[model samples]
Target: MKSLLFVMIAGLASAAMLVSCGGDGSKASASGPFGEIPSLVSDFETFSDAKRAELQGGGEDNMKKILGEMKAAEEKFKESMNAAFEKVKGKEVVTEIDPELPLKVVTPMKIEDISVSRHLVKLVGELELTATAIGFDSYEPTDAFELDDLVVLSYDNNGKPFAYDGLSKDMGGEPMPAGSKVPVDTHIHIESYNAASMGCLSKILITLKGSELYDQAKAAADALKGK
Candidate 1:
């Protein structure tokens, strides 16, 4: 009886030692009220290998489900990345000015202020572009300085003509005296520009032509040069 009592006491002591030594304070409880639910492992590194395996559970079906969820999450992330990449690639490039049509050509008729927005553009400049006839003794060459005819050429990012916009100025061939100057302001509504090659107008070219004075002015200047 004493031996039996000793054996029972030894077994109880051994059980207590085992319980105290191997305890990790955590208790086994289902993550949810139901059974297993597929979960996203945001920080898989935080869990031990054994704990992670236990969370995944022990079945071919469970393993497949976990892998499928992870794969789906990875694919979703990749798709979003690709979408952002495409947006960056398609972003519009800005153009400052058209080199072929420099502002210096209209020297005295300068562009004072310019504003651009997503929808429209506003431009302010001198209306009357000065046309100096070097050696014209008569006022016949003065009409070219009036700029009765003005044409605008709008270009896109690719330097292709997009819109043929008209200025709001009322020059209308109103006829100005020799060396007369006029100031003008104009606005262009980009949305209203209905052209085949139109996307975003990156450059604008303003041209003035005095068809009648072209040969006459050159002849006067050449005559003066020869003398």
Candidate 2:
């Protein structure tokens, strides 16, 4: 479950961000240029609150049902996305599901640096994340956040994932005070590689700073989702 936490989170991030970027490209609208995933995030928030309400009401079975429903929603979102891409590019795409690596939305921050080339588009931004202990959920004292790692993601019209190794494989941190937790921050960089296949858009590549403390991880995630 721990390993798959990312996959779940990524689902939320994708659903929310895409919904937010609907055709308008106007921030004031319920959906932006990205599509309808942001609305899903809002719905998830409501669902979370409802789940909590159920727990308070001693509805454990209800909680399980809600979880199942959320999973179904994610699947539906992907299907809808595939269909939409077919309209934009005029082809169907094959998909690969990584059951082990669910993605989570780190923090909702505005992204910039969107660029386009003949057959590709690129963007860079930072991910503002709340840091917790390495193996615990409690926030670490003294060093509560990070703001250094940088990420970069790219997408070509061809469907293939790309991984880039950074100059530093590991990000070192400041000395921790006794009992202090690991520092976490939202300044990570996320690099993505996307392509249009069978007229559908898919993320074929994703690269991020190796450590949770890098400033690039967030940017990469944003680029992937934004595209």
Candidate 3:
């Protein structure tokens, strides 16, 4: 019973973060893949709360029914997200590891898969990394260069550049040793209206974090606000 409650709470938290909230205390109209998320989350919350309260009366059949409902809702949510992601499956983006950058890309980065929900687009891929002399200087030569010290930039079809929302790699916090090729799984986030257009990206640039290029890209992405 406790385990079921924990799962329900976790699902709620995950769903809450996946959608945007309106300023007023009302459900915001979604414009992307997760259009039904707000209502789904609300329904699940209400249903779970009612079920939890009933569980206090100790009914095994009630608990089983709750579990079945939870699973159904979860499957429905996944189907919605999966269908949305399918719209962008074959679209390819040209990925480039900036030559002037300190980090050396031993393997070319490619968009192996994509996932979209609401305004967030996630790009997944694998790449190999090694540090150069310049990398050493930029990343404190003695210490291992961490994957978190990487920056990603994406451009639309019109060639307008924007900074990505965030990046995550397999060996995230660990130091990337210099002169050795290390394979890292990468997941990058970018904000967009839909998966199709975002998947058809013109280009993606990767550079060292905190570089001047990153600042410029961030500024460009930020300037799009209100427009």
Highest-scoring model, lDDT: 3
By TM-score, highest first, what's the ranking?
A: 3, 1, 2
Residue-by-residue lDDT tens digits, candidate 2, 119-149: 1212222221233212222235644333233
Clashing pairs in 3: none
TM-score of 1: 0.30
Task: Choose the strongest candidate by TM-score.
Answer: 3
Clashes of each: 1, 63, 0
Listed in order, each prediction's TM-score against the native is: 0.30, 0.26, 0.48
Colliding residue pairs in candidate 1: 127-182
Candidate 3: tens digits of C-alpha lDDT, residues 38-98: 3334444455577667668767887787778767766775676566456544434456776
Ten contiguous residues with the weakest lDDT in model 2: 190-199
> Higher lDDT: candidate 1 or 2?
1
Q: Which parts of model 1 have CA positions greater than 4 angstroms off?
A: 1-120, 132-146, 170-179, 192-200, 208-227
Stretches of candidate 3 off by over 4 Å are: 1-81, 87-92, 106-119, 130-148, 170-179, 185-200
Provide the lowest-lDDT 10-residue window in model 1. Answer: 33-42
